[model samples]
Target: MQALEKRLKREVLQNGKVEILASSSWCVPVQSIDVTYQPVKRLKMDLLMKMTLLTFQQAEIANADELSELLLVEELFIQDLLRNLTGTGLIEKGEMYYHLTSKGMMQLENGIYEEEQEQETQQLLYSACHEVFLPVDIDQMDEYDELPDLFRYASEEPDGSLTFVEEELIEVLQNSREPEEEGEEQTVITEILSKETQQINDIPCLEFILYDRDKDLLFARVWNTLLSQWDDKLEKQLVEKEVVKWREYYLKA
Candidate 1:
């Protein structure tokens, strides 16, 4: 505390152009959220699809109706299934026959299919004061006991929206996530379903009120303990430009 005060006095206010009027410990609000997402899953093929693909593997069916009678399956069902297989590029449908394509041959051997489902949830964070999402690991945060209450940033409800930075979310999701082994199916978060707020928390910070002696004005500079640096953006947006409103807040405080 003494070292910081002396440094601030020497480097920041040595010219006497600005004065450090007050300083206090601040609690910056943060919201913890569970983001539910639907990932692209690679699953084993169903029995029906396996049977259908196997049929194509054997030989092309000249007429599904005739084959259906011998196979004890409905004719219309076989036709629809063949059309679906063609749609998925697993089989090639000729004008009067069906055959397996190269891709279909691989699927027949692997017996794996791609699907998009199975909701997975991950915990993440949001900086309410900055109105942005963060990929910060919560376990690494350095917390402190209650202290001098200077200011407490208000918390915001996490809406069911994926409006945050896409890269940040991707980084968070990809961290510590990987395929277990070679030839293993990799799960990717292709769609974010929802973000539900689970808890509201606060990160402690050092907030200082600076008085501009020349202009007879007041502003704030906030130090983010988590990042161990000054929050210039929050200072600029929250208190720097709005001198009038923040001055009023200071007086009220």
Candidate 2:
């Protein structure tokens, strides 16, 4: 009994919630039927796991400070567990923090019935991605710019093909090329870009370009028009990895 107590105590220290689930009365049985019953009788143990994970997920929602306080684990430990959970699609890591993955959140909600909390978490994540692509006036930047060259320069000018460039080089060139007359009145160009008119002639395409601006030649263009702004080869790799992750998350037993 002393040996078993030490073992259980060690396990409880390793997983804080284990102590909460362990019932004192369960005893090892000599019969196979008793052992079978023991396995089936672990519903509370499963519940404890759900509650512990839900608590950690809630801490993530509340913020990093709360997470640190509530989880009682070292920062490094939390980071490792979160990384593993994200790799297994049990969590999602964003620019600033982490959240439960779709399946994780769904399981938590179904297991806990905390609908409002789950919806709030989902909205927060969705809004973060949504704001990234929303129409914003680029002219709002100090640099006064235009897209006439982009449209005129396009190899095949589609009606809505005047592309937007977020590359700093193109932005600098546009700003520096200004005819002193604009006098920092750049927002006009921004207002035009903000319209997102989308008509063949009126709507301009936008690309968030990033590269070494010092190069004299514009031989390579990184267009942000695709679902992910990456070259074909890089995009293929990303797609394959995403597919593999999806398979692991949904198709694996």
Candidate 3:
């Protein structure tokens, strides 16, 4: 990864933008590029996985909707993540709810979750690289002056077209929008917020995009969105799951 980063920095010096074509196995043919990899924020997969485990620990029986709200991630993402966890025997799904498996509990307790998470991270990275041009925009930096991370996940439409949505990128664009003439700014904001939601298999998702203004580079991180729009019943369910404990705890306050 460090080698790739160095190569990308060199390429950025000569080109305003560079395109990355990753093989299905997530391998980038270095000979095909003036650079091998572009700079990006490190993936947060570990944090996300740990958070998911913690959520299950907190709520004994929870669905993707509940987990989405708890994690502030898109429902579709939660569902996909759950599926991956299930494959590792870290989680199990029955009907529409999910529970941590005994193996999962043991891994968390023994700090083995980190190792498992690393393996999963590698898989996700390879998946994101397959046959996609991950474009990184080189003219803008996120609010933190940091480049956004990249991941591979997309929703397929009925017509067979792929859609990628990035809530974080959208949020960054919205927050960083320059103030315009009164009504003009409002219009821009509205347009930004009105970005159509994308989904896969009817599951909500977003595409990832990374930008590095310092290097004048941009790339698409195509991934599922972390914005789940669940119904009120789901929220109520989460409340009920911990309402008694919440009440008892807050009552003293």
Candidate 4:
């Protein structure tokens, strides 16, 4: 908790816009689930989009009325498509014509059109150790520190306790996400089957009452000791889990 206090004073107090009112400690269990899902990938553009862009490239410069006749699509629909294209800055609309912008030409050069397709939507345990709760995703950090046992997954029934082989289950998510392909939409996970328990670790936290004098607002934020950072998502999760109460509950103090 020393780390939490030092960080809060150093990072928060220096800002004149905010001040720390009070703080309290609490323990929360965070679960790590090895989510396995089928990765369905596709480009952001669909067939019509590809056709529209190609039409622009072929015709070089054409008005919506001309494009509609050339593509054999309705003029109104073509107008909508052209409007979308211009809105995204891929194409520019001239006094009376629409043409592919340099950005649109680059998309064709990058093989984006070739990959156009459809996609659908898709969708840890806690252990208490030391005074600090370590996260199962500790592997994400560069420094392992000195605690070798922190990484080891406990065997079933270790020391006759409740078998700490990544104990318990909870609904939580960690990014462990894929690299974003700039401007390209990727496949979404429809559902999550299950996650293998890597290890059980506790998430120790300090809830700090923050006052934004500028806004005249008091809010609650949880400082994650394990991650050594203020995790807004985890703070919201804790509030949802009732680990932290509403601001009114804290202001009474």
- Top of the candidates by lDDT: 1
Worst 10 residues of 3 by lDDT: 118-127
User: What clash count does candidate 3 reach?
Assistant: 22
Candidates, ranked, TM-score: 1, 4, 3, 2
Local lDDT at 204 for model 3? 21
lDDT of each: 0.68, 0.33, 0.41, 0.55
lDDT of 4 at 143: 33
Q: Please, what are the lDDT tens digits per residue for candidate 2 over residues 1-253?
A: 3343455445434633222212221111010000000000011123433644676576544344455556575666555655545564656767765667776776566552221111100000001111122222322222223332233222343333333443422233234333545332222111111212232222222221111224311112122222223234322333344445544543458
Off by over 4 Å in 3: 1-45, 114-253
- TM-score of every prediction relative to native: 0.51, 0.21, 0.27, 0.36
Better structure of 2 and 3 per lDDT: 3
**For residues 66-141, what per-residue lDDT tens digits would candidate 4 score against the true structure?**
8777778889998887776777667887785567788788865664532322432222334432222234354543
Candidate number achieving the greatest TM-score relative to the actual structure:
1
The 10 consecutive residues of candidate 2 with the worst lDDT sum are: 31-40
Q: How does model 1 score by TM-score?
A: 0.51
Using lDDT, rank the candidates from best to worst.
Answer: 1, 4, 3, 2
* Per-residue accuracy of model 3 over 1-253 as CA lDDT, tens digit each: 2343444345434544443322111211100111111111222236788778877877765577777887789989988988878886888877756777898888666544422221100001111223432222222211222223322222122322333344433433444435455431131211122223222112121221224456633333322212122123222433445446544543335
Q: Rate residue 108 of model 1 by lDDT.
A: 80
Candidate 2: list runs displaced more than 4 Å: 1-66, 109-253
